[model samples]
Target chain A: MRKMTKIDIITRPGKLEELKEAMYAIGVTGMTVSQVFGCGLQKGHTEVYRGQEYAINLLPKIKIEIVVCEVPVEAVLEAAKKACRTGKIGDGKIFVYPIENAIRIRTGEEGDIAIMDPEDVEK
Target chain B: MRKMTKIDIITRPGKLEELKEAMYAIGVTGMTVSQVFGCGLQKGHTEVYRGQEYAINLLPKIKIEIVVCEVPVEAVLEAAKKACRTGKIGDGKIFVYPIENAIRIRTGEEGDIAIMDPEDVEK
Candidate 1:
């Protein structure tokens, strides 16, 4: 069983789909995105101009999370970087960590094979 | 300093706002909501037809997370139960764990004072 690497990504909502597809291109489709607020090394926040609430989230950011085998860690992360590039505040951040295991409830497959990207294995 | 307990909540998107208010009523703000897929003690999944994406999320679940002081843990959890009541499969589950410390990077306040609920501390 390969150790799964979880990526924490924050990018604009508009760029979310592109980022998701980029990960898919890297053979990582089983992923999750959450509307999240961040205030880490960057201190992501929102600002108000008019009384109207700008869903633009002065601190608007999307968290793209994917669990992938360690072998493809760098590829997946790099793909995300390229896809979610704004080179500015609110563009987001990516953090990686080890995922001990993953399981597919439908197929009853456990570990990497469960949520494994079919494309990566062939590469 | 009180230990922070993290709560993992899974409920319908429709019930999300209500749940948030419930947690807030219990003096828990500063939480995060994530769209999630679950198949835990209950196998949460989606059904598809017509090849059209249904945002209804047949297995839609919301994760309501709160960092709370130990003393009010029970109260917060109870508030959630009362508010998010479907008594159904997607109603979700709540798990609590200990948080050793919390820091408000902005205020430079460490431990309890940083993210402490003003209402809880007053009581």
Candidate 2:
């Protein structure tokens, strides 16, 4: 483990199981989330009023990634800020980074206790 | 382009379109967000309280990731900060990393200019 700390999260799209149980109750594990489309202009990308070329829509979003090791990275950003809140306007965004390596692709174990668990990252 | 940066986002379940538009408006692309299950305590990991290892109800979640040139990292963060927010619970997170390289599958480009779009990544 050279030094690691990565916590990137996007929100909405139904809360992703309450922010993955609030980042696995603060202990974190392997993580990666996908499914996105957020090309700005405040959600107004498709337009062609005169001749008609409209139909861009594009907005749905969900992106989560966690690669811990930097001593829990502040408890996974305080349990993902209490599981990606909700008081208005989409509600999502947390970032922290400083990772040089993390490998466990079925057994390439490397760094920070080989990313925890798995029998202590293979004995 | 041998150096880059990475951002990862995770949150909610019902908000993809919004994220996409938001990111693009801010100028970013080629991100990944996938469905996931999170394990932890506060959410209560499945238990065999007594004689049975009860159901392991993993909380659902999503993960998103972005790798942009170092130049646009701050802008991306600012836009994301504004876009992903609610204010009560589960307020997702974001993290950035220094990338060593990024490649465009369509072309044989590697590093910075490779990830912007099909337009710049080509020879």
Candidate 3:
């Protein structure tokens, strides 16, 4: 069984398209994208409501999850940083975790085969 | 020095409400929910497009991510299974990963403290 790593990238919503292109360029095609609310170190900006200031803790963010077995983890990280970085807070964070196994429900393919792109498999 | 685990649950969107209630009942409050697309072994279903048959490979799914330290991992799994399971194809999957660390952006809290519910901290 090959080792698999799941990379969870939470970044600015505006960077999705660029990020996708970067991932595709790196041969990382299998991904799950979603909208998420992130509450991080930024302290958030204050919003005034009827002469009162309230802190909005949760901010809208986009999360992209990709599990890789063939691509180098470093490559994915570099691509993400280059595409998503703005040298500012709210640029988001990345979390890496070890995946014990992954199974494809339709074909029952497991591990690396379960997540690989067909084009990669053909090559 | 608590161990933190991240559970990623991908399930039918209709079960979201039930899953949320289950998590709340178990004192698991902090979660990130997102809409995603899952492609698996199901082979997809056929759809007519312009009088032509097309295979829809991707299925819409709801992914909920939660990082837990104090709450028992098994409990979360059980609750999720109970809420999301339909004993049929496309029921989705659950993946568990080891979280090296977690941080709260606003207060700079790290590890378990960063993810615990305030109510849990008070107690």
Candidate 4:
């Protein structure tokens, strides 16, 4: 069985479109995208709600998760960094974890095969 | 020193409310919730858009991510499975990953401490 790695990229929400394009360019066809609130080193900012100042620790962010077997992890990291970087504190972070298995619900395809695009399988 | 594991639960969106209640009942406080698309063996379903039938391979899913140390991993899994299972297809999947470290952005806390609730810390 091939080793599978799951990469979680939590970054600015505005970067989603650009990030998707970058991932596509790198042959990452399958990914999970979600909106998330990230509480990080930036310490967050204050917002005025109902004329009252409120310190919001959780800032809105976008998290893109991809489980990869065919694409090198480094390539995905590099592409993501270049696409999302703004040289700022809230630029976000990337996390890498080991995935023991991935199963397709409908077909029960597991591991690398579960995540591979059909075209890639044909190729 | 503690073991931190990240559990990613991707399941039916309808189960979110029940799942959250289950997690909270188990002392889970912090979790990142996001909307995602899952493409698996289910093969997807077709829908009519603008009088044209489109084969939508990707299905909407809710992905809840939690990094835990104080709460037992088994407990979380059990709660999730119970809340999500419907004895049918598209019930979703549960993925476990080893987390090397976790950091709290505001205080830069690490490991198990990063994920602990303030009230828990006091107790």
- Candidate whose TM-score is highest: 4
Pairs that collide in candidate 4 are A40-B105, A106-B41, A106-B42, A107-B41
In angstroms, the error of model 3 at B80 is 12
* Model 4 Cα lDDT, one tens digit per residue, B19-60: 999999998878998778654421243533234654533567
> Which whole-number lDDT from 0 to 100 does residue A107 have in model 2?
37
The local lDDT score (0 to 100) that residue B65 gets in candidate 3 is: 90
Tens-digit lDDT string for candidate 4 (A22-59): 88788775677777777643245554323565465477
Please tell me which model should have the higher lDDT, number 1 or number 4.
Answer: 4
Number of clashing pairs per prediction, in order? 3, 82, 6, 4
Score residue B30 of candidate 2 by CA lDDT.
Answer: 75
- Cα error, candidate 4, residue A32 (Å): 1.5
Evaluate all candidate structures by whole-model CA lDDT and list the values in order.
0.59, 0.59, 0.75, 0.75
Please rank every candidate by TM-score, starting with the best: 4, 3, 1, 2
Q: lDDT by residue for model 2 over B1-123, one digit each (tens)?
A: 456877655555555666778888876867887676543222323433234543433345555677888447667666665566554223344545577777767767777777776664444
Candidate 2: residue A68 lDDT (0-100) = 82
Q: Which ten residues in a row have the lowest lDDT in candidate 1 chain B?
A: B38-47
Model 3 C-alpha lDDT per residue in residues A41-93, reported as the tens digit of each score: 43656533345654754777888888888889999999999999988656789
Question: What lDDT is reached at residue B93 by model 2?
Answer: 47
Candidate 4: fraction of native contacts reproduced: 0.28
| lDDT value, residue B11 of candidate 4 | 80
Candidate 4 docks with a DockQ of 0.20
TM-score of chain A of each: 0.75, 0.30, 0.84, 0.84
Better of 2 and 4 by DockQ: 4
Q: What is the DockQ (computed on Cα atoms) for candidate 1?
A: 0.07
State the displacement of the C-alpha of residue B81, model 3, in Å, after optimal TM-score superposition: 13
